[model samples]
Target: MSVARKVVIEITSDNVCPWCYIGKKRLDKAIARAPSNLSFDVRFRPFQLDPTASPYGVPKLEAYERKFGADRVEKMIPHMKAVGEAEGIKFDYGGLIANTLDSHRLLAFAASQNKQLPVSAALFAAYFENQQNIGDRETLIEIAAKAGLDADAARAYIESDAGEREVREEVAGARQRGISGVPFFRIDGLYEISGAQDPAVFEEVFAKIAESA
Candidate 1:
């Protein structure tokens, strides 16, 4: 018999969403536990949790308060810190912001070259760990290069609005699917999982997909 076709996983997430980051880590771990013979293609889609964010980062603390309310964010910090520790991911929540639209566009550019996941990871590291303003064109290009994209060409593309249409299309697709949050995962383009869950959760999902094939 012919081997089963690989599944495509569509992830709709904003880089600024900490849960999205954690969710990706969990998904990675889950995929690691799946059947070796099975194959899958992961695609990160665009979702702007905060569409009104300015190009320049807003003050991290204030921005969080505005997005989720002061009390709620304050209560969540300790939990986020603990989760970060568990995942070996840093929580510089102090320096990040709510702007990720341009970051999404840059990911689209990277996707055009089949380098979306690496570029997206770099973008996440730049903003969350390195505390860089990922929305900045220069910064985004640099991250894109680190993710194996051609830096000069990426810079040019970002500056010339060459990938804007593709970015918009992805955003529209997300909207059409009724995705309002980050880290949304559609496994094999069929099974859907939302939220930044545990690595075990991803493993369970991966097994299900593999078995079904």
Candidate 2:
């Protein structure tokens, strides 16, 4: 008799972080390629790259230019675009960058529905590939509906402050854990990996864990 080995992975990420998107893509690939005997339970925790950004949103390029300088943003874009293209992501600088608090709230609700991953992916795609403003309530409800949640319920939930406290607390917990950046992975709550690492890194870790089990 073979018993499947189960592993839990908690990813702390801000929806607007480019590196978090990249890290998620790589992690999904790694999980797909892992041994059949290993099953993964992936959950997401909240983080905020810019908590003070407006809900109305601002152009990603403009925000970057303002914060990092136009010259630096110009230098950063090409490299980010090249890296993103390698991962099959169409990076767009014209997308909106806004406070991700509402988006985080939506994700918390998705977790209860077991639709978090798809919802998260949809949000990232909307902002990074489709140039949609994820901070908008309507936009988020649309994303939730597309991710297999009921649109009306999503709208109702987003209109209220249902998960705000929990989301904020989780974000604070992540920071208290000394995670100063997005794309941080807490594997099995014991082993940790940070940044948008290569898929092979995850595969190796999974293999080691399985062997130990």
Candidate 3:
């Protein structure tokens, strides 16, 4: 079949953020349900909601409560649970929240292997569902292994801060682009879609882009 056109969807998100997880799932659905002729080159960009988060990790609930207050935490949990469930994500919220620099670096390594998306998904699941610490080297290496990445190489990469500068610069760039929150989608260097929008919204935008192409 002849192609409508190709589109590059760049997603800026963090592993520890629940909304980013939901956004990723919804975007996956959108891409899967989009027009067949419009091939997609999905790029998972790096962003950290809290750049100062401890690499050693803090209890998820404690961090949320400290940052957002107990009342909001109470409300946020149910909202996340409901939204997460809709996206087929069973958010445990019992995991540790850690600095995602290493997680982002690991994703950069995965990009070279053409496994960025799966690795990103795995990182989210590791933090949000599996009660694992994404900031830890062994946990990241295990997640990397699960994503078919070379374990020794991945361990060496994450252990040494190989992509730290590049990832930090990329995160800075996202901020410089006026993005303060995550799950930001930049499509084809032309359109911008913010937040965890519905799959239908993505499909509509995709169709419009394809039509114009």
Candidate with top TM-score is 2
Give lDDT tens digits, candidate 2, residues 66-185: 999999998998999899998899998787888999999999999998999999999999998899999999999999999999999899899999999999898888888799998999
Question: What is candidate 1's lDDT per residue for 1-213, written digit by digit as tens?
Answer: 668558788888888878888888878777777787577688888888767788787778888788789999989888888988898788786564746777888888888899998998887777777788887878888788888999988888888877667767777788887887778988875678888877777677677767766
**Local distance difference test scores for all models:** 0.80, 0.92, 0.90
Q: Model 3: what TM-score?
A: 0.97
List the candidate 3 regions with Cα displacement exceeding 4 Å: none
The C-alpha RMSD in Å for every predicted model, in order, reads: 2.0, 0.9, 1.1
The CA lDDT at 203 in model 2 is 94
User: What lDDT does candidate 1 reach at residue 26?
Assistant: 79
> Model 3, range 1-213, lDDT digits (tens) per residue?
575688999999888878888988998899999877688999988998999999899999999999999999999999889989899999897868889899999999999988987888888888888999999989999999998899998988888958899999999999999999989999988889999999998999898887777
- What residue runs in model 2 are displaced by over 4 Å at the alpha carbon? none
Clashes of 2: 0
- Residue 207, model 1, lDDT: 75
Query: Among all windows of ten consecutive residues in candidate 3, which has the lowest summed lDDT?
Result: 1-10
Instruction: Please give me the total number of clashing residue pairs in predicted model 1.
Output: 1
